[model samples]
Target chain A: MLSLLRPGSNPRRELEAAAIALLLSIAIGSLLMLAAGVSPGRVWFAMIERTAGDPYLLGQVLYKATGLALCGLAVALALDAGLFNIGVEGQLSAGVLACAVTGASLPESTPGILAIPLCLAAAAAAGAVVGASIGALRAMRGAHEVITSIMLNAIVAGVSLWIGNEVLFQGGTTRGNTIVEGAQLPLLPMSGSSVNAALVLALVVVAIVWFLRVRTTWGRTWIAVGQEPAAARAVGISVARVQTLVMAGSGALAGLAAANFVMGHKHAFEEGLGRGTGFLGISVALLGRSHPVGVLLAAVLLGLLSSGGLAVGDLVPKELMEMLQGVVVLSVAAAGPWVARRSVTVVPEVAA
Target chain B: MTTARLMRVASLALAACVLLCAGALFYGGSAYALERWITGGVALAVVGVACVVAGAFGSTAMRIAAVIVAAAAIAGAVLETATHSELFVAVASTAFGAQALKIAIPYALAAMGGAVTERAGVIDLALEAKLLFGAFTAAAVGYASGNVYVGVAGGVLAGMAVAALQLGLALRLTADQVIVGVALNLLALGGTRFLLQLIFHEGANSPPSPAFENTVLSNPIFWLAVAAAVLVPLAMLHTRWGLRLRAAGDRPEALVAVGASPSRARFAAGLVGGALAGAGGAQLSLSVGGFSADMSSGRGYIALAMVILSGWRPAWAAIACLGVGGAEALEIQLQVTGSGVPRELAPLLPYVLTLIVIIIAGGKGSAAPRSLGRVS
Candidate 1:
């Protein structure tokens, strides 16, 4: 027991231990499945086969990955700035509502070219307003962003429910008003899936964010604030301004994600459209270690799990997929400290 | 502080309250309007007063204020019911009485668990997972054994298992405790959901058990919970173990110097927290007679908030829980009455009030224990 208290474990050893832990978790999950009278091997096989079994299934996975990628980027940006914006769900919902409302309200005779930008702008604007409120509260009153963001999430949920149920709700139906054909996102031919041009838009935004973070003076200041707030303030950085901008940018990205889902696929705002994607973005960001390219990979991995889970519902229960996803997140998170500890030796002089 | 500044702040807060109330009233109309108004306003007032009392007279005063507010809210509800005034009755009964208790009890129990763990210097943000574990375990055991007692025991054991896992990571490996806690929660949630689907061929919700009974005035569980509320504080203040736990939290280095293992204290506290949270889950599943995926909802998070609002005192946390719980119950009641109040606003009343309270309290000098989220 006392041996367990010692620190300074080697990096190689930690990695091996993490690998062992992952294997052990899978073993335990298998045992659980066996106890419940299911074949663990069959479930695993089903999960793999369903994801890569067909081109159509593969397209769905990619489509889902696109949204996760954007949301993950949003989360990564905000988290790197030392902000925990739990209100991403709210921001995304509001964005969806805004895009749907704008799209639906557009005249059928309106030029399709103008309507597309208008819908995206409306979505971004909605998300920005919500995100800015959270930033302002943190910057001005010093409210804990976590708490405020959570509260804002609830508020946004209520507002979204109201909009879907009362205001923008399609009369005599449970769904929202459908967008005009002119406002509908153009889909790629022969894809069969509603995969649209927004995928390219999301990629463009990702590149822009990467460039801004790596190349701009503003990005450096933002990182400075995140790494050492007092030091940044002493150096004449406007912490509040940086925070506000980070939040707005995060919100706008989240909104764009929602727009991609609504205008591009569903063609209307729907209750529970955001589902838990907002919170899922956090997991993606963590798994990716806040790297843009890493986020893309993480998002794809998650998308595979989700789409595969749905596809194999006849063979393995969806709950099993959820369990695997949860295990993946847990293992990754648990490994973080061990990983950090190993890297600590390389930068012994700098305190993390 | 300048009078002008104080006045400005007060007016702004009041304006916020008025706007929220008006929003609810307008959206809901006269149907449950009174309930909406009281639910939103009274809950906010309770949080505001608790903050002020905590600031002025110390944490002990805050405890007293929380308890008094809870009791008063309940009494006000009963009185409203007695008077036959529609407005008062609607507000009091629906906003402050039975409904509020439901919301508060789960939160209070979770908060108490958090308080003990934090007071012992272990970070615990996995309360939600603990709750799910308890709920799932209790439901499963109850179904298998056909005994509520067995279910409760199973739930507590599940919580203990989570605590043990957390301890292994936090103490043995010296992992980032918060992240570990989060991982544990996710694991528990997913694990429970999977097991439930596999075993019961259903989602997380469980069927009602015959052995379980609602904890009304005549029920033993009601009294047991009350006993727990009273005993936790007394034990914390008077017991040798409690002092050691506090010492471990406030200054683990000092404790270590004196030959005490901070890790041991933390482990013990974590176990106790698990037990409390487990009991809360049992109460929810067994007392309610059935389970749903959304049953726990965000109660665990609310409990964490209550721990902050109550300054880490068990008794105070209980009272605050009751207040919030009462507000929730009242919201449901108001909604049932079909008063003009919008159903959405009624459900949202407690959260909005909590937000307002946090805003009014401002960010300076929170009553949270200094040792919270800090591990040696």
Candidate 2:
């Protein structure tokens, strides 16, 4: 799952690949819908109508999108530097763990300005610690990030579950203590919708990432290291430092997803909170072509599919919706490159 | 420069951890310390001692003896810690070995399956997917038909189906192999859950099925794993097809020079690998006599890790899986013995051990196939 598409030769080629992939996924998805004896048109229509009809439901999609955008940016950030850090799952969880504990443990009288920033910082720091370890392993031991990521995922899952079960767990239930009232993010003006200021945070992050990638020397340095590490080194850039920073930066972005799950919505640490968001983020990043604007749009698109899956549960098996999503990812990963190859001149294989 | 420094720092950190555990053992002997650090602590200390002895002695036999002694020390330490009395004899009984072997069968098979596809230059990240698919098919088919062998066969086919999707997309369509595998994993996870509800009308699990007895002795799948462990490596080295498959992974150009299709070799290996993994999945559900959502858990990933640790050799991977299984069995034993370790943290044992072992033993650049994870 980690080594899918090495970044394509150019941004234009990647865009073409993603478009082609989307078309293929739709084509295959329709076939699957037909085979399953479900009406594709009805399913799509119902998914769209049900989700868009209710303000609460629409807000729920935006809430989900808030997390997805952060996570997608996390993955996309690492991809920018030519590294695959699949440990976003662990990083995100680490953030949630820390953020939840910090929020819940804070003094009840603390102001939102104080408590919120403290919790957010806790989340980011925890996630960055995990990410930095992966980076350090690569820099110091030449350990593959994928291998370390797998190990860390296991460790974090166990550690988080242990802490949840032992320390934070409330009696007779799975979840832990709720956050202090001051730490809670305010709900947006939408009537009775769970959407909160975190949506704004997500967008602000997208813009920040855009600015970083576009305007900063740090941005260009990482991309240089990613595209050609040896050449970047010859020009006095420390590839190791850039890679490590990229992983840490990626980790922090993933950690920031806790803003939606912990502060904005759940208000507590729950087991399996933001469970599959990290992996889903990969889909978003790919579909969005690793661009900030593209990721924001992709996150919203996925949020629709996710929320819509439940809306259409009566008409079709909700699991099929997930399968279709996976199909889209696979199709894009496969046919996107294939279509791009068809259009462009063949590049000679780089020597291993 | 970095590798040496890493080794020094790692070993030193491990050595410090051992010293801390020993100090805690004598002073307070907290259960928390024992649960998390003792096994790793003793294991690393033993390895360091063995390394020093071997280096000073400077003979192959001496080195072997040092390693043997270290192994014995680790086993003794664990046994002593697990059961502090004559209870040790009971824990070491035949039943314990049986339990460990039964647990190992699926992991071993899955890891070996990982070897087949990975050695052929295809990532088997979907091994987890195959495990779930295989288990679901085996249980559902076994329940519906009341035929154990048929259910196992069905599981194998399910595995092959996942493998086909992965290989076809990655090899034929020129999709990114990793992405295709990841997609398949997601599909397997969700599709199985959806199908469970659709077919069984229950989300929790399938109905009890006609399954083999829980013992590994009665399980045909166990023997298959054993056979693969013994034969797969030999086949990979000795057979013409195996040679071609290896060429596909390590040097596809060599296969091109010989005019044998690399993708065909990969496809064949993938199918066989899928079957072995599928059988492992069958054993999982059949032994339980039902299918549960996400029942394969993370065994597939553990198997994937085992592949890397074993240097992508099928038999070695299978052997490494036994250690993991043993860790699991030891945990169960400790819990039964009323050991004071936190029950919630018990699940961390095998993973923690794997991580420690990987850091100490793995991360070698030489072990991987030169052309692994490449498109021809």
Query: Which candidate's DockQ is highest?
Result: 2
What global local distance difference test value does model 1 have?
0.68
lDDT digits (tens) for residues B260-298 of candidate 1? 887887888889888888777766777776555646656
**Alpha-carbon shift of residue B375 in model 2 (angstroms):** 1.9
TM-score of each predicted structure versus truth: 0.85, 0.91
| Per-residue accuracy of model 2 over B175-293 as CA lDDT, tens digit each | 76766777787778888887887788777689999878877788898898888999999999999878988998889888877788889999999998999899999989998888988
- Over the stretch A142-162, how does candidate 1's per-residue lDDT look in tens digits? 555656676677878886786
DockQ of model 1, rounded to 2 decimals: 0.36
| Candidate 2, superposed: residue stretches over 4 Å from native | A1-12, A233-236, A346-352, B11-44, B47-78, B85-87
Candidate closest to the true structure, highest lDDT = 2
Report the Cα lDDT for candidate 2.
Answer: 0.79
The interface RMSD values of the models, given in order, are 7.0, 3.5
